[model samples]
Target: MTTMAATRRMGRQSWRIFSMQARRCSVAHDHTSSSDPKLTNFGYREVPENEKSKLVGNVFTNVARSYDLMNDLMSMGLHRLWKDRLVSKLHPFPGMQHLDVAGGTGDVAFRVLHAIHKAEHRAVGKLGGKSEAKNETRVHVCDINPNMLEVGKQRAHKLGLENVEDLVWMEGDAEALSLEDNSMDGYTIAFGIRNVTHIDRALKEAHRVLRRGGRFLCLELSHVSIPGFQQVYDAYSFAVIPAMGELVSGDRASYQYLVESIRKFPSQEKFAAMIADAGFQEVQYENLVGGVVAIHSGLKL
Candidate 1:
């Protein structure tokens, strides 16, 4: 085909796929709203509250192998810096107990451990003595999807952290964490809350599990409201991201839902309010990349 003709054909194909997904999303929303009061969004589509988790699980499972690569591609490797900022805000300390929820790729958890290790070393350097015992320090990585947990475990093994007792991996739901109250010094979740069926419940659970003065931090994709930039961002999100997903991971539908879910998520201001309502004090948020992402934090007191 001629270059112009091929370009036109590809554009047509992309639009067709986008339209089909939109129709399905609309139908799902209509059906659920009319028939079931207990429904939550799976991207733009509505599904039973209980079923959203399984649907989200399927998406992660399908893209698990390519998750990190796709993140690099979609964000142009900025995700690494974003995660670093999240951990830095966490201010990990030696002999601290931390929980990283929905961090199935071990990204945030690894950073937390690295920060704690550095803190321990710094203490030793300051005192001119051996590092204090960190046997009580632990970083727990919790996620509901077993496949994602397995991926985290495999990555931990490859990084030689499999034998580290301070790093623990568990399969558990964020809304109902299987942890005792006042058990954690810090909590974090990255790029994962948009898929949650009940974000409020998860926030409450974070509060419930944290000790007084513990911090909760969340990094997530959010809305972009800059006038000219919003248009460009929307075009990129609706067009380029799904195309990249199709070419790289052979799963355009999942990426479509992923971006759509970002839109469905609460705004930074509203979410910060939700955290406060969940009994957190000093709730605040910082927007990054013109609000393409945000980090929300709160302290339990």
Candidate 2:
């Protein structure tokens, strides 16, 4: 079937599922409660707002070793393209300091440094100067997963990125960062924010740590807007992905939950509104690869 046809079919199925769920809920509860209904945001897991971090930590711990490989397999290397696009937009300059939250494996930080080096070289070329490149840019990678951070640090060391010394890895929570307010020039989170339970709290934390005029960048899986693509994507995500995980990482359940979480995340417009609500200004988003992923940029005023 065409992509449009697949999308229409999925829409009908979704409506049917919703109707069935509503009927079940109505039958279970004839009377309304004054208290709020228990909610499971994404991944179909029941969790309190306060417990999301721990739950997410468990997920990272389970998949840290296979995380990078799975990313390559699942996105067919398109994630690297997305990251490269994010780096291009970042336009990192020399001496700029960055904080990468939930930046497990340091991919974003490494890319930021690469961008800075490129910018420095470009400036040198303009000056008609012959100067040895110096690594002075700084970035900190903060995550709740120590093992993931360790893997990133080891990779950095292997690359002889001595500036990796400047890349501090801290076991930290995104919702409650320990960094000082208005201290960072840039902030980034890749495929990490959705795992956060209290996304608003994390956004607030990002705003607090960012200086005035600082940029906040997030790259994540997003709801695909194209017709017919959803069915193909859903089939791959639900069936092929878990099988790949089992074959590659020996973990199917974690990948299953990961896919479910992506489906459960808020739509692009809803997420942009949340960013604006968290005190960010001039929020904008760019859809990549037909909206399979998106990069959202916001500025702190």
Candidate 3:
């Protein structure tokens, strides 16, 4: 049991490990999977609907070790900022429970935990705050890929965040979360909802698992709609992105699929409507980086 003083002493400097890992992503180049034809887009190419998850799973398995690095390289480190924005808006309080779906890297969980720590410490005005573990502000990080969950587990330990339980490192799908209905105080899936085969089903699952007043927050790449900026962003995403993936992950095809999937995603307005359809209320979204990405949030009212 680390004291708040000791934990605080460990310092926020540790948070930069994620950044360093990202920076470590090789600028060097290399080149690299997939399923069915029932018909889904595997990066602009249609494939069996059932095949998409398997194909996406393979992409993650191949790059799990370098996933953070690739994220850094691809987003030029902006991903960290976007995640930070998500956590800040969450405003997680002590003893609040959260579920970070498809965020197996512990990225979103860590931020919420950190925010809780900061808040509690501020309230107490000391280093070693009382354990909230009994009613801890817990976050269950769930993902379909074992490799990705393993990486998330490793990151959680590296950050000295193992005080929680196995619920923290769970294996589950977005479309059918294993968690009980109305069990969590918050639900978040950053840059992951679009990958689901039935995003509507996933949205409903999100709504189902969250307690009344719980919020569903998602951060994803959005279609750049501004005329001039859209052209430039499109060129970069279609051309420079996969090329960057080749350099960083030695897997151009996987990255190409990622970029193409973003293009396949619905516009913000339509997506917000889906959330509403899924039974979430007060739905809204905000564009970031000139519409390169957006954060959509709703309440399970």
Using TM-score as the measure, the top candidate is 1
Give the root-mean-square deviation of each candidate in angstroms.
6.3, 5.8, 11.6
Question: In angstroms, what RMSD does candidate 1 have relative to the true structure?
Answer: 6.3
Q: What is the model-wide C-alpha lDDT for candidate 2?
A: 0.76
Cα lDDT of model 3 by residue, 7-96, tens digit: 222211011123322321110000001122145556557676788899999988988888999887667677898899998888887777
Ranking by TM-score: 1, 2, 3
Ten contiguous residues minimizing lDDT sum, candidate 3: 24-33
In candidate 2 the C-alpha lDDT for residue 231 amounts to 57
In model 2, which regions exceed 4 Å deviation?
1-42, 128-136
If both were scored by lDDT, which would come out higher, candidate 1 or candidate 3? 1
Q: Number of clashes in every candidate structure? A: 0, 2, 10
Candidate 2 lDDT, 38-108, residue by residue in tens: 44344766565456666777878888998899898777666788899988887788777788888879899
Ranking by lDDT: 1, 2, 3
Clashing pairs in 1: none
Candidates in order have lDDT scores of 0.83, 0.76, 0.75
Off by over 4 Å in 1: 1-36
Worst 10 residues of 2 by lDDT: 8-17
